[model samples]
Target chain A: MTDTRMATDAAATWHARLDSPDMDWEDFGRWLDADPSHRAAYDAIAVLDAEIGERAAAIAALLPANDDEVAVPASDAGVPDAGSASRGTRWRWAAIGTSGALAAGLALLLVAPSNDGAAQVYATGRSETRSVTLDDGSRMQIDRGSRVSVTGGGTPVIEIAQGAASFAVRHDPSRVLMVRAGGYEVRDVGTRFDVVSARGRVAITVAQGMVSVVPSGGAIGDATMLNAGQSLTITPDKQIAIRGRIDPARVADWTDGRLDYDGAPLTLVAADISRYADSPLVVDPSAADLRFSGVLTIGDGSRLVDQLRAVLPIRARRVAGVVHLDAAGPR
Target chain B: MLAANRHQLVRFFTGRTGSVAEAEDVVQEIWLHVGQPPKADGVTGEPGAGPIANPLAYLHRVGMNIVLDRVRANGRRQRRDAGYVDATTSTVGAEAIDDAPSAFDAVADKERMARLTTALTGPPEGAMRVFRRHRIDGASHAEIAAEFGISRSAVEKHIAVALRHLRKALDD
Candidate 1:
């Protein structure tokens, strides 16, 4: 095969493999880095897959109709969040245990986690919010567009694969509740802490008691102690920044529809807004660094944009699907 | 003019809001607003009260303004259901809601949907079944292969063929 043909075929195979839970990321990374063409081909395939997934229902409707409702496989081992998988598909998975290998793969992919013990996955959809009490007596408030897998039989562990979650743990020294996000892990030494993993940044805020932030991959030395009224933000590039003396009560104020930004970058604010609303809010590179301080009540997503326009010397316009914020022209 | 281009307007709103339901609501609100008198206490049936020199442009401008107002006025306050709580238990969930794509994204998505519909017809029936079961039905490859009485590798190959064909069609 020609090099281009080979790359395309390899990309297709990679796409199929990655969709399975058994994919070895280390091997995939090596293959991705091996050739530049591979990366391009992979990107193309990924985009296509995402597009197809988004419109799967609509396209499927147009195809030759098959009324056979796939039955859900008998076991609940692979069920992540029942709400996440449409009821029809869940039943199909539950009923389709004809092949043990496929049933195992379905469980792994749907409940995608690396837990030593049995894990239960919790997920919130675009605008959905769910609060669940763990078997260990800990309460977790899940953020929108977020998923966290909880493994509780021995030591309680939370693996936040995406979005943010606020944890209010009942102080138990005998069984530590651990939160793993990105490359860092927050071990609760009996405390209430908010762990936000969004936009390539993980910020851990200690509302009460104390917690230790340790690098999961050992990229850094020692567990950093974060006490009450303190916050630690780790950027994707592994740069650690610490903030002291933040109001402990204000930690997770978003639960009350209030976003308190004390001199926060506009880009960060935009990222937060993008989480709640669909419109892509773009701050011009020139205005991206502008800092804002105050309380913005997020009602409808657009009002926040209006509030920003009122407070700062910026022009906000909704063009097509994008909300563009630019430095206002000199009067 | 707005009535003439109702479908187009709905598409425009859908692109703006990233939701067909919201788009329909916006269009309905716009229709109501257009029928209402511009000023309260004015005659609802008065001649030329609702007429515009450039009806198309006027319809679009009014439609967009209403959407903006609706967005500004809308506030989503999530009531806390009795599930879990601590000292800091609040009524609202600390999360973003209804993350919609911008107009550009909606347009692109529409284009992709059209392309996907066309490309989906290219693969053979067995390959299409594999792709559909895995993608739409959310079945595992092993399950799909078993259902079709095919080997695991063959199932993967069928899916790869379907994906490659679709990806190629998209690139072109």
Candidate 2:
């Protein structure tokens, strides 16, 4: 076989194992490294595979059903005429048992760490939520498009770098959990609260117990103590801090696919919607300060803007990939 | 885990892009996607969220997807540039000004779909059926093998044959 043909065959074999649990990525990496031609061949095959996947529904509509299967005789058994020529090479792509491979791979990665405490970063993709439990039995339900990192040693510190996260900390008198976001810090001891830090703003809503929110570089005495049903937001400019009341049950409602807001700024709502949006949802300056109060169900995250438009006098326009929301003209 | 395997991931990307700087950029992009937190916390309870079965494989898949998106974007840009030049050179002022990039993309997409349809018929006799079943219909190799009364390997071979044929046709 020619070198190109050989590489194509190898690429095909690799493509078949793309989703297999036992996929040996190390070997695949080596194959790509071995020859530049191999990478080119594999790229062609991978891109073709993705294209086919994208147009699968359209292609399915174009093709006819495989009714010929019923016409073949039982005595001919499983041999296809087109496959007969390559019968000798059939063993090359034989199916292997896949059970337990996924479990084994997960096991290798989830090994419990030592008390030395190395930081681990956890993040969620668009419209994807993740729940992580800390060593001290604290649970965190991370919202989509959010990033949180935790370091467990003597004192546990949780940082919400972007997006929103809800924390339910287990009571530990010896350890005070420190949660930080947008240059502000929250100290918690056996409490549940939600923190949203995005677009240069940090908002924390207390659902249960009490937590102290401290400004960046502020002493503990300067911390604002928030009780249950209380919410505080530090604006993007850090010039104004807003404290409001919220129903404790409404905290982190996105976990149930519903965003419950009680008079939230349009800018803050836009920032929350941007997590599920394929593109950034920017509010026009005219609509930025509008207060919105409603429950928006985030089903697949497609109709969020439409839902917002129905409730408020806002018009959303797509220019390129960004969604710009402006106040609608009088209708 | 991403931090621990950074070097290997960079090497893997470098092999594909054939440039260390490009590979480093890709790895950095991945890091930004994954989000890096400054501090750490202790963890001990069961994973309350859906667990990714294999994160390394997941990361590799994500890397390949990023590469594919970049390649597709480059292709679209090149096509759009060529189309823009054609419109400006062949048409008068008003007509040329009316031809937007979005319209050009629509026309290019239609042409590409036509080419794909033409290439669909280039595969071997039985290969098309297997490919359609596995790729379009979302059937597993084992399921296709059972339906055809053939071994799973036969199903894979048929798919490979179809892909090879389609690649050749489309490349031309």
Off by over 4 Å in 2: A65-234, A239-331, B32-49, B83-108, B140-155
Cα distance off (Å), candidate 1, residue B5: 80
Candidate 2 is graded, for docking, as: incorrect
Worst 10 residues of 2 chain B by lDDT: B40-49
| C-alpha lDDT score of every prediction, in listed order | 0.60, 0.66
List the candidate 1 regions with Cα displacement exceeding 4 Å. Answer: A1-116, A219-221, A238-245, A279-282, A299-303, A317-324, B1-172
Give the per-residue lDDT digits (tens) of candidate 1, residues A123-198. Answer: 8876566787865557888887788877643246788887778888764333346898877888774478888876
TM per model? 0.40, 0.49
Error of 2 at B135 (Å): 2.7
Candidate 2 lDDT score at position A58: 66
| Candidate no. 2 TM-score | 0.49
Interface RMSD of each: 24.1, 13.7
What tens-digit string does per-residue lDDT give for candidate 2 at A13-83?
Answer: 66655544445666777778888998788878867876775666666666555435442233322323221
